[model samples]
Target: MPSLQALKRSARYELIRAGLEGTALALNFGLPLTNPQRGVIFALHHVDPESPANWAPNAWLSITPTFLEQAIEVCKEEGLIPIALEDLPERLADPQDTRRYVCFTLDDGYRDNARFAAPVFQRHAVPYTIFITSGFVERTRSIWWKTAQDLVMRTDDVDLSTFGIDTRVNIEQRAERVALFDRLANAVNDAENEDTAIARLDSLAAAHGIDPLAITEHLTMNARELAELAADPLAHFGAHTLTHANLTKVDDKRLETEMVQSAARVGGYVGAKPTTFAYPYGYASAVGAREIAAARQAGFVAAVTTRPGLLSETSGKAATALPRVSLNGFYQRKRYVRALLSGLPFRLRQT
Candidate 1:
């Protein structure tokens, strides 16, 4: 059974989606009623077309390569100039500049980013930032979500008793698989020791006939690939913590270690310390004043949350708590992209 909070969130998202679709025409052409600022930071995860079928439990986290290409083209067509993340401060500082800008940021340093997405970005000559979790690149930590999904999809029955999850699930059923993944993923996210929870999950996955580490090794960039990506002029590396741990749950010492060590490791690959940071599982509860202060102390120039809103002059002041709109998998249509970038949906929601 889905938690009440999860159900409520799903309902809220559906309402927002309906609003975006309903007000698409007015938003695209009408005078802007929201913030006058003309810049957007897009957050994305997986960018490869792993399956032809678009419907999946984790579909929202991914967009096909074709969709990515079309999105960039749509932005260009709509007169939104592609700008590097590093250039955003300068652009935001210039109040006189009237041109719209978009900055691309891909989280998790997925291997597919290098294999599939990078080529598309390169062809379009767009600059992007890839936030890497050092432990993921070092293979010292596993992507719990991926491991959970694989276990749920591969086995008809799973014994999650070890994780204190006493739920009956038939993985063969799509709905059950999604629900199971949600429960397990949420548990991992809220766990006190996320690393231990993930390690235990990996053990369960191995016992059920799959090596989670081996499977996910190909999903994220390795140290060598990170170095290569950092060398690309179109690409910039950012810290996403050492283990992708939620900073809010850890003590001050551990929190600093996660932030500082991750930046240092990426610095080794990029030849300079990363100036940007993306909070792991970036949500309000996962990050707050403490995390923001830590990012500043770690010497990050900017930090972005998964919050949905447009960037404005005021946002420049709150660089550490900056908002970004996800190029969500559910809203894949080009018109939807225009509506989101318009800042109208978020504005109307506020009203």
Candidate 2:
């Protein structure tokens, strides 16, 4: 039996799938007034040839390599050119250059990105970027999300009450696991002192026979691996903040260090200064005028957010904090990918 969360996700997926079908039909009919963007940038995460788990709670963070191949084909079929993230700001700046474009960017330097995603992009000759979070590559900070999932799934019951939850949580059933996963995620992200919260989780995982640091080392590509992947002409490397901290709550000095040093570290592997940035958790709250300003001050040519939408002339002006359409795990169909690029799903959201 599926958990309530799974059922909710299924219903939401169906709703968006129906919306995408409408978007595709409308796109075919040519509704330029509503869908005014000439191009889009795609946000992606894990791309692996194998399914990570049978009932993976974090499944949305991943996609199969086959889906990636189809994604490239779909963008080409739509008449959009595949470009690098570094070129986007320049393209966005030119009034005469109205050609539609698609840039692929995967965040946090995952191993699967090099193992599975790189081959497809190389085969298609598409220019793609990997935003490297230095701490993940060096195993200096916790890749808290992956660690949380592994700990909750492996242990039958978890006592996070010591971490400040009032009650001990059961993780035997899938539903129980989902609830605990969410609870733990909230505890960590929503905490006043996030580092303190993360330490508690590391301790919790250790108590339950899980190794948090090992999870980061295992999942992410190291400095040497990144250096090897950078040899591909089709590949570009960009900086994601060192610790993957929410940029908003951090101090100005810390923010600059996170942004600048992260890029410098990525540059060391790629043999050039990385000119792009992707904000950690790039949502409305995490990214704002301050973070955008910091990107420019850090010497980044552009920065991307997790905000959903297509790029237009008005939005392209603020190159530092640009929006991107997610190449979502739930809606991995080629038509859905086309629909996302068509700008119709986001258009429908306005009305």
Candidate 3:
């Protein structure tokens, strides 16, 4: 028998699909505007289906293989040009050129990236950047979203009161619960210790009477796969962090180690110093002025955060602390493409 939570999730999926379909229809028939002067930088994570199913929900943020191809076509038809991260500093220096642009970036360096997404980029001649977690690539036990999923699905009847997580959701109210799960995922990502976060998941499972390790078996990507992907021309590597820690929670020295070590390790594998960095859980609270400075000191040419905005001529030359619009699962609607390029809104939201 399906659990109430499972049944609710099924219904929520239906609602989400309906909403997306409606949004797509509106984009195709209702909102058609031109912004010849603007471009967007898109963010992606988890490239393959082999990711721990529980830990990495495909619906959380992923493009179907078909959507990936279609998005490329749409960009070309709409007169958008896709550029590499390395070229962004140059292009943003001149956003008035009136050539539509899109810079594609993948974060977290999952092994499935090489297996799934790299070929798509290569065939399309698209240039991309892959930001990696050095600790995981270098053989350290780490917590990733997939591992978190393992904690969720494997554990049943778990309690999370100690972690301040609320798991009381009936099937009819699951949309809200799943949304809360998303926030909890972010909270876990922001936690200082990977172990603590894992434990919290375990506790959540214990509260629900499920096994904690259900998904850990499928969460990791292999080192050989990462090395192979690093050698590709269409792809470049960047630093996410040593252990994927939220830089703001740690002290300066630890932050430095995470940043510098991650860059060094990834650079060694990719045969080039990682020139780009993306703050783990990149946001105002997860990252700050100090963290940006630290990335620069670590020798990254530019850094990106989860802030929603496009780069402009006056945005400054500190590529190490560059801002980016997060292109997650919810941003699939084509209207978002326009929203991302519209600099006026971000600048307005800034104040």
Candidate 4:
């Protein structure tokens, strides 16, 4: 594990490079970098410090307020314009002009996005899209990460009933608990029923003498709050399904309902027909070429995944099924961003 100081330093460098300053001469360094593609969509999750360990494989890649500011400056300086997913069809028709543009999108509809991220975009006059999952919107529950963090921090013990792995945990057990957390979190993440997962969390908290409901309340956003954000021109809504289930594991009918219904419900509340879809736990194993094509079949213009890479004109129209680098907590190094954009640091997992 990287020390907090090491992580912060890494983050500072990424901010410098990807944020406006590094972009100025970044391409000249002969890394496999490309100018902002016709529609390079940025994917982000939570911005809340309270929710540190995100579901993304490496949460450190997430941008801080400082990094976000730099990113905004870089976008404007590089002449990378923003567009909504609804505008993609028309923009794609005029490829040359669109290739240099960028779009900002957030997944999971966390409150900090509206509370923190939106203002940054607004201050820069950039438009952004928020892909919301209805379960969290109506329920106002703590998201998975915050729930897990609360379990780890608030209690001196934890029990993993769902996985049949029960144990007591505390600060001294921080390293061990994080390892255990990852193990159980994966099972919880992979489970079809969030309730089953929650029950396990409840059992775990109970074992540790923590209140599960209190923990749940701290993680999610409510419908009313999402509605207010939808009112903003810069804020557009998209589908993240009713429940955050892995779409690939479900049958086609259920998948469509999850994909289409979530879009419709969020549309009704947000007052706009969403045209984009972001696959939950989007990756090669969780979703691939077929699932992405299905999202398009469901009337979406684009679908996004967690696969790390760039989207270029040469990348294909299925660029709708584009791979995005997760802006998470784990990615702190400026060199990492340089490597990612230059196409040198990370590679897609070959399944």
Top lDDT: which candidate number? 2
Q: What is candidate 4's lDDT per residue for 1-351, written digit by digit as tens?
A: 533543565576555345433442455565444444553567787664443554323355355765666656655655567677556555665655545556777888766788788888888878887888887766633355555656655655454544476544344455544554565566576678755775676566556666654543454566777778877888888888887777777788988898888999888878887888889878777796668877888898777788776656654467457777666555544444434444333332222
lDDT of each: 0.81, 0.86, 0.65, 0.65
Candidate 3 stretches greater than 4 Å from native: 1-38, 48-58, 94-100, 159-195, 198-217, 316-318, 331-351
| Tens digit per residue, CA lDDT, model 1, 104-166 | 999999988888889999999999999999888888887888888788877998876666667
Clashing pairs in 2: none
- Looking at model 3, residue 285 earns an lDDT score of 80
Q: Lowest-lDDT window of 10 residues in candidate 3?
A: 49-58
TM-score of each: 0.91, 0.94, 0.74, 0.79
State the lDDT of candidate 2 residue by residue for 173-251, as single tens digits: 8777776777778887788777888988888888888888899999899989988998899999999988999999899
Candidate 1 segments exceeding 4 Å error? 1-13, 28-34, 51-55, 94-99, 167-169
The better candidate by TM-score, 1 or 4, is 1
lDDT tens readout by residue for model 3, 82-120 = 887877766666645545567788877665567777888
TM match of model 1 to true structure: 0.91
Over 4 Å off in model 2, which ranges?
A: 1-11, 25-34, 53-55
Two-way TM-score contest, 2 vs 3, winner: 2
